[model samples]
Target: MTLRIATAGKGGVGKTTFTAMMTRALVEKGARPALVVDADPNANLNYYLGVKYDATVSDLRESLKRDQPPSGMSKPDFTALKISEILSENDGYDLLAMGRPEGPGCYCFVNEVLRAAMTRLASKYAVLLVDNEAGLEHLSRRTTDDVDNLFIVSDSSIVALRAAARIKLLSASLELKVKNISLVLNRIKSDAEREAAISSARDIVGKDTQIAAVIPEIAEIGGMLSSGSNVFLLKDFPREILEPLVSPHET
Candidate 1:
């Protein structure tokens, strides 16, 4: 079974960094060949994962409007083939980026094709980690629905917590098939802040949601992000912060 894990948070809240760390943790735990989907329009998950991608699903969709596949090939087959070509394969995982959102034109047909292709590709992996946008448009589109675990990340700020609460509410309103939804309080500065953030999160996100992980604010991670360094290079990468998120998927 593919363990579908998604990370959602407002911009600048460290969701991408968390996704990268979680990917490393999953690989270290023997979860090989995971599928990492960059569901954000401003795609950078590949950079954090230390991989480069030339194309994206949205890029293919746009091209399909103007170009045609080889002679005698159907559109669906062509789309699937293009999507497969864009997948950036790596040692422990592969990255698929969903580039910029749709433009003025209708994309119902292309979206359906992309969704189907993504579903087919996901089945070949043991884990699927999606780094989603702030609004979670990917989930709303059903591009990556039926999530096994949804991690709503937030910094130690009231505004960020409010955003997290809204994301949780939106997930419920959309009726997304998420088996477990948790709040990941990230980049905490101190024990007091972590405690306060957890308490505030519990109150805001409600008791139904679990406080899955509280990650401390590590200067090394911040430096790496600022310097565009690979996630694996961060010494003492907080694997403990990800254990809670990874253990459940372990066999």
Candidate 2:
């Protein structure tokens, strides 16, 4: 099964971490190769994945906007070259970084082409995980709609629920082709906290969607920030949570 998962939510809510961890786990579970599109402008996924790319989608878009690469290359040729250069392969998955523009206003054409190319590329992999910007590019509608599973990651804060509700509405307005709009409540400390987090998410989803997983707050994860050692081996947490979210479809 080809599952495209889009992880989106407020900034600092562990969206990137969730995306990276889930992708890694899927790889270990004997799934076919997976692809990750780090569409967030911050582009921190690269640092976490420990892969250095030569160019980004933004770099390519800038090349098109600027009308030439630094070496005066054509857009199509530059596109093929940059697409290969920016895709980093490691740990049985490849990461494509959608970088922040070095300078720009909008990336209309490049974004369309990149999305199209990705849609075609999606058929080749077992999964495509997208880590998107936080309402920055208005990309949620397009990115999340095509996914097989779209998780709205949130913290345990009250603000998180409210923001999530808004994001859900925004997603609806964008008319995204969401297969399953699931919520992932992250960073809970205690059982009580976990319950509260799940409850909060339930309220936000409000009779339509459901909480897929509640990830416990792990101190070690914070410590691994600079190392890029994702939660592939997060035995207690990742598997505990993700197995349920995806288990039914596994068989």
Candidate 3:
């Protein structure tokens, strides 16, 4: 069984950065052939992972309306083949971008086909890491339904904590089959700010949700990102901060 992990938060909350770092850490720890899905419409995880993708799932969905499979090929098989073609294979993982959001139309057939294809593809990997948008659109669509760990990231701010809290509430309403949910406070500058964020998060996300990690504001990481360097190149990245989130059995 594949270990499914997902990161969710509002825009500019560093969820994407966290996802990238976690991917590098997983790869370093011998978690090979992981499938990293960039579910964000903005789709910049490729840059963070130092990989490039030609097409996105959205492009394929759009093409399905106009393109047909070969005379003897089934639509599902063709869709799966296209998905494979778009995958950006890297040293230890494959990247799949969700691309832009769906346009004005009913995508029932296209969505079902993509979902089935994703499931088939994910089974070949040991882990599946998804970088989700603020709205949790992919989860709502049931594209990646059974998540093992859902990390809600938030910066050290009241507003960000509130947004994280709302995400926790939304996840409950969606009834996602998530085994564990944790709050990852990112870019915390001081202990006071961390305490405040934790307090706010507890009130907003409830006491049941644990505060899994609080990553400090590391200037090296910022510099590396600004230089368009991949997360793997960062020196002394606080990967131990993510250890609590990954189960021992899964690793």
Candidate 4:
């Protein structure tokens, strides 16, 4: 069975960073080559994973919009072919970026197609780590279904905390069948502050959604990212971050 995990929060809160780290941790646990889906239109997960790709699902979708496929092929067949071709490979994971940078008109049709393709592709892996856009728009749109665990990442700020609350509330309102929704407080200065961060996160998002993890501020990580370094290979990322995510029972 494939485990579906998603990360969300307002921009700049390190959702993408955590997504990449957690994926590496899973691979370390023997779940090699997990499927990493970059569902955000901003599309920087590829950079964090240290892979380069020229095509996105949106790029393929736009081409379909401009020109019809050969008469023998159906739309679904074409979409599937493009999805298979665009997966950027790495040693322990593969990436599928959802769409290119924003363009004119609605991408509803393409999103629907990509969603279906992602669902189909996910079963081939032991885990699926999805890095979503800031809000719950993708969840609301049902781009991902039966989300096993949803991790809402936030910085130590009121705005980011409130955004996490709204995501929990919106997921409830949308009736998403998510088994667990946990808060992740990132970029703390010290381990001693974890309790305070957890308390604050609980105050904002409520007690039901526990603060699953607290990631300390590692300057090494900042330097790595600034230099366009591949974070998946970084040695300084605290292994404790995986404690809460991989073994939620302990948290």
Q: Relative to the unseen true structure, what is the C-alpha lDDT of residue 22 in candidate 1, on a scale of 0 to 100? A: 91
Model 2 TM-score, 2 decimals: 0.84
Local lDDT at 101 for model 4: 43
Off by over 4 Å in 2: 62-82, 102-105, 139-141, 232-237, 246-251
**Candidate 3 C-alpha lDDT tens digits along 21-104:** 888888888877789988777788988877789988888776876899989998777887888888899989999887765565
Q: State TM-scores per candidate.
A: 0.89, 0.84, 0.89, 0.89
Per-candidate Cα lDDT values, in order, are 0.80, 0.71, 0.79, 0.79
Error of 3 at 179 (Å): 1.6
Q: Write the per-residue lDDT of candidate 1 for residues 50-104, one digit (tens) a residue.
A: 8899888887765878889899998777877788798898889888887776664
| Worst lDDT 10-window in candidate 1 | 105-114
Lowest lDDT block of 10, candidate 3: 105-114
Best by lDDT: 1
Going through the candidates in the order shown, the clash numbers are 0, 1, 0, 0
Candidate 4 residue spans exceeding 4 A from truth: 65-74, 101-105, 247-251
